[model samples]
Target: MSAVIESHGHDDHHHGPAKGLTRWLYTTNHKDIGSLYLWFSFAMFLIGGVMALVIRAELFQPGMQIVEPEFYNQMLTLHGLIMVFGAVMPAFVGLANWLIPMMVGAPDMALPRMNNLSFWILPFAFFILLSSLFMEGGAPNFGWTFYAPLSTTYAPPSVTFFIFSVHIMGASSIMGSINVIVTIMNMRAPGMTLMKMPLFVWSWLITAYLLIAVMPVLAGAVTMMLMDIHFGTSFFNAAGGGDPVLFQHIFWFFGHPEVYIMILPAFGIASHIIETFSRKQLFGYSSMVWAMASIAILSFVVWAHHMFTVGLPLAAELFFMWATMLIAVPTGVKVFNWVTTMFKGSITYETPMLFAIAFVVLFTIGGFSGLMLAITPADFQYHDTYFVVAHFHYVLVPGSVFSIMAAVYYWIPKWTGNMYDERLGKLHFWLSFTGVNITFFPQHFIGLAGMPRRYPDYALQFADWNAISSVGAFLFGASQILFLFIVLKTVMGGKKATPQVWEGSRGLEWTVDSPAPYHTFTTPPKVSL
Candidate 1:
């Protein structure tokens, strides 16, 4: 393959990317960086999946089987941290790096060099985090949320490393968000207005702002934790004249919007897939943009809902509960628009569409469960149970994870210049969907029956559901191998795809050559709705 591929821009002297390992190290190309982000995210996904298996294996029966209680806690903490930070966030950023420039007819991200730096820093961050698992006291086992005294007073020697690693990751996220904001705000092609931008771009625009707003809060929280542990500050220490509840306040303030940071890009992805597969213009394009913005705004206020059982005032509980519930309004608008887009239109259940539909249905289930948990009185019953586990997994796995898969299936043709095997793709989808339900559905029942979360051993009464859930988890984990195989096979070689890979697709991204050129729209192609 030639290092230089011809781009659609007027420049005839453009050169292709360099070959070999050096291509990744010093390159500022958005596409190469995007590829790096995607591959890195996949590796983290596999690593996290293995940790999850360790957890499920232990919980498969009434007693511990695979690992000790301490190790189990490590696995639990690492799994959550890796999946949220390592897999989901980076994957969405990769999509933004790859598609946002192309969709908006820009040459590349505004801060291309910073984009490269941000991505490269992630490995070290996660490396430091994972290395703590082998340290003398084991990894930070206070859970991914790392609530107050557990992360401070009783924490391991490795907690210092964990804190530094968190700081690094937060810095990376902040940088990535800045690059996205600059590129989207300043680099659009002439005549391309905000209202004319694709839903994906709009979603990312809102997401980028949310990331900028919240990542600093996370950094502050960790810094406070560091002071509490090392310098004897009592920001979250009751003995030192601080309130432990304050930690939850600070964490959730950042944590709530952080959840949206993972899912908003997914909303963009589902919108594009639904509209493209349905052969219709998005039913409520303007409203969809507003809805995403609305959701982002509401996210900041609802952070306390997660801490409903922490003895907040009744007024505070009512305020958080209603604010949290209000998010459903904008979210519901998005779902209704997707269905409306699909209504009475020529619909095809392609691989991407399959995943998109599953995301909608399963994510809604998560959303409804979230609403149930938002009820102050009801949350006291549901707090820290497997029901909470089921809720987030549904949102993240099928919700965010499925959307990432759908984006790959929907756009791989453009990225690779080859069409994936439809049959294999569908098979992967069905297996994943079934596996997810099998794994998570039983959890809901067990949780309702009073199975608290993060326990290595459960009473015999919870044994059947635990075993069944573990089996489903193993099945789901295995199905991902098929997904990897399908992706690799498609990349190796398949049917060649045309410029407009999907007939109904409409965007500047599809206007260029298939397997999109290394440099595209260098001359700033004109855009019009």
Candidate 2:
């Protein structure tokens, strides 16, 4: 194949994937770095999934089967930490790396070497975190939420390692996000303006800003916890006049946006897939951007909603309740936009579109649950229970994770220039969608029926749902193995992909060479529209 195979964009030159370990160590190429982020995230996802399986296993029957109580605590802690920082966050960053530069018609990320450095920090950070599992006591066993006092005075010998690792990870994310923001701000091709840029880019730009603003706050919170742990400061020490509740506030302040951080790029992806398969101009395209921005801004204010049952004062509760509900308006606008975009259009159920459609239906269910969680009195019943767990897992698994699957399905052809086995892809999708619903849906019932979260065992009354959930979890886990096979098989070789990988797709990314040329297309494509 000649270096220049143009179906979507004109190419004047070519480059190849970076050279060696050092190339990986110091890579700046957007695709190379994106590949690294993605591979790393997938590994972390499986690791975290294993931990979750352990959790589900212990909860599967009514008693602790395979793990000790302390070990159970450790499993819960590491699972949350890894899944949040490891699986979910990195997946979005990986998407940003792969799509943002291409989506906005940029040459590559703005700070390529720094990009390398940021990513390299992750293995070390996670190493430290995972290594803590072997220490004398155990890894930090407070939940991944890691509230103070528990995380401070009573934490294990490994808390320091957890904090240090988190610091490095935060640094990595900040750098990655900064690169995305800078690349989008500066690197667009000749005719691509702000509005003309893809929704993926816009969603990530907002996501990146959110990352920059909040990751540091998280670092600071941990640093404060470290001081309270070792340096003997009172930041979260009730004895020294510090308040534990204050820690929750700060944590959630970072956390709430962090949740959006996971899903915003997903919104971008789901939007792209839905529009492509639906064969419609994205309904209210500008409105979609505005809605995302609105969600981002609103995310910051709703952190306290997560803490409502903490016994906040009446006014504070009222304020948070309403503020939380207010987020629905913009979110509803986005959901409506997707539905309306699909409305009256030729709809196809290709794998990418299947995942996209699933994301809409399931993510809305998650969103509705979130609304229910936001109501002050209602949350009193649901808070700290499996209800909350079910709500978030829905948003994340089907919500963020499914969209990631959609993105891979959508773009595998472009990257590999080989069609993924559609039959295999559909198999992966159905198993995943079914497994996910079975895994999470019943938990909502269990939660409302009073199943506490972060527990390894439950009473016999909760046994049935937990058993069903665990089985679904296993199937979900096994289904992902099919996904791995499909992606790997496609990458190894398959039918050749056209430049416009999908018949209805439109983008600068598609304009580039399939299995896109290294450093090619320095001459950006002129926007035809």
Candidate 3:
């Protein structure tokens, strides 16, 4: 295999990316598509960040000063949708497109045309979703989850558009997942066995399976919503022999796994970053793989925990409580692996390491809060409150978002052949770190004091913390502008990078050129490990 790979003729048919607009539109090249996904996700991140600033500005005072209550609801709804569907999920997929083939020694994604189709559909999906705000009834105000009667009976005329957009997004996700699974399963270079594969590949493979299983469930849930709205079906309409709780069950059935779908890749990324900076082979490599697989499987059975506030029978409540809490075991195993990997190793706190460490600590805080929410009785106290918002944002912003940022910092040098300004990167990190805690830590107290989420106004008692939170929100949002600048600065020009960008980095990816070639592994490379 090694001889064949070495003897194979280099396919010079590949030149660099096509010039101009046609490069993005018609190209099936993984690198080009990956760049497209990353840029698109970043644009959505900025748009979503603006919506968040609006929400925080409204909450800056005790009254609805900045916008009308209706507009406020639209901001919150669009923020959630855009961040989840448009930013976080797509960013991970973008990472997968760029890294997976390199890590596995595949030349390209298994279905190249399908990959292009999957990515191209996203802009259209988001276009439909955003276009809804301009529609007569305004955007989806019922929240990203789009729970029952509110989403069905009381939803806007744009709900139909929202439903269609969701279908398009789901289709995109499913196709992307299929492409990932096929590439990983069948395209590994010779000698690159399953256990020897990097943690990022493992994480994404699990995530791909999870996506394949649940994206359809989400599509079905929305289709049922469409039917309830137009066809007069009672899928969620209690008056017509359907139960609203049924919608919660269906939505959450997809929603629980959906949360893991976003974070599991983060887990993968943290493993690589932690191991790299720690200057050690990853601790518990097999265990990390099993842990991710465990978390993905556990995600399925824990759906009902989100619906605990709604009327669930005693047995079902207890079942979900135990199931949700059980997920903590594998999750703890992962956190332990990261820490143990770093213990007594020559660790360096570079920008990626800082974010990875933050992901570990902050994500654990969110996990503990999640455990609190898992307790059926306690959730009754915390459900629908700002505390819930705090918990998820902690998990998402610091956990997933931080990890994504870490990946960009860690790999951008390889992608661009230019090192980002390390001082500026750390500065961006500190601002983000400070801003995130200041913004969310206070929400826990306000939530405990009986302030609910999704409200445009708050009581006088909630005024002060809300003001502080808004300040932090502004800081966090502004820091991302620095991030965008850093990325562009790195891409355009900076200190030149070596093939092995990080001193201790280990992977097939690092073996390639600094800015990996237009074509790689024309002949399947023989993997040593």
Candidate 4:
């Protein structure tokens, strides 16, 4: 087989930016679509962050200052919906779109038409969701978890739209994951066997499986909700012979693994950056892969942990607690491997590495709290409080979002054929780091003090911490403006980059030329590490 990639879709006719607004709509190229997904995700993140600020501002001094209880409920609901569906998930898929082809030595996604469908589904899905805000009863106020009666009988006029929109979004995820799985499995360069693939690829492959498995379950759960609401079937109503608690079972069945799906690719990104900046091989690469797979499989068995407060049988609670606790074991292995990778290595505090290190310390802190929540008795106190809020934000923000930022920093050079503004990048990191810790670290303390989450206001005792948290939230929210500026500038132009953007970076991506062309590795470049 020839080592050189020369045909490169010599006749397929790439559909991407021809220099303006029409580009995003017409594009089918993975990089172009990836950029679209990322920018859209960021836009949703900003919208969601505004809602969070409103929530914080309301709680700062207590007593319904910013809006009514009803309005505050809307803010919380929108914040959760936008952040979950619009921000984290799409960002990871965007990374998959950009990196999968590059890493596997494919020119583009396997099914370009399906890839386009996936990207387009997002805008319409979000439109249906956001439109709910204007309906007579307002957007979903039942919380992001959307438990049974809360989403069915008691839900607003908008629930119908939300259900159909979610169906579309789930279809989009399924199609997107299918494209990625096919691309990686079939399009890998010669000799790039499954086990020999990069950890990032390995992690996403697992995440795709998780997505296919659970997204359908989410679809099923929502379908039941729609049926219970309109047809009076009562899948969740005891009067009609279905149990409300059953909703929690099904929702969390999808929800627990949903959390893993968001963070695993983050693990992949952090591992790559940590190895590169530390000038070391990823510690226990095979073990890292196994750890992720273990987490995915374990995620399915532990869904009941989320429902301990709903009066489960003692035996059920105990079983769920044990299952949830077991997840911590594989998770701990991953944390240890990252730290070991850093140990005695020539570590540099580049922006990406900085974010990766923060992810380790902070996600571990979150994990410890998660394990605490797994205890049946302990969860009684922690169940609906800000502690759960604090735990997940630490995991998702510093853990997943930070990793996304870091990946952008790490790869912007290779993708743009130019180095980003390092000074500005470092400044963005410190601002984000300080703002995040100030924002969430104190919530742990407040949770211990018994402050609950999702409330618009709080008691006087919670005032001082809430005040500090609001400040941090604003700082963090605004700092993203700097990131937007940095990425826009980097893509425009800077110092030229070589094929090997980072000196220690590995894999087939580096074998291709910089700012990789419209087509790449058409003949599947051989990996020779």
Give the Å error, residue 157, model 2: 1.2
Error of 3 at 210 (Å): 0.4
Per-model RMSD to reference: 3.1, 4.0, 3.0, 2.9
Instruction: Please give the TM-score that candidate 4 achieves against the real structure.
Output: 0.97
Residue 38's lDDT in candidate 1: 93
Error of 1 at 327 (Å): 0.8
Error in Å for residue 435 of model 2: 0.5
Give per-residue CA lDDT, model 1, range 12-32, as digits (tens): 668898999998998788999
**Candidate 2 global TM-score:** 0.96
Under the 3 Å rule for N, CA and C atoms, how many clashes does model 1 have?
2
Q: Would you list the C-alpha lDDT of every candidate in the order shown? A: 0.93, 0.89, 0.94, 0.89
lDDT of candidate model 2 versus the reference: 0.89
Candidate 3 regions exceeding 4 Å error are: 1-12
User: In model 1, which residue pairs have backbone atoms overlapping below 3 Å?
Assistant: 3-16, 4-16
Candidate 4 wrong stretches, greater than 4 Å: 1-19
Number of backbone clashes in candidate 3: 0
> Mind giving the per-residue lDDT tens digits that candidate 2 earns over 181-290?
88888888888889988999999999999999999999999999888888979998989999999999999999999999999999999999999999888999999999
lDDT of 3 at 138: 95
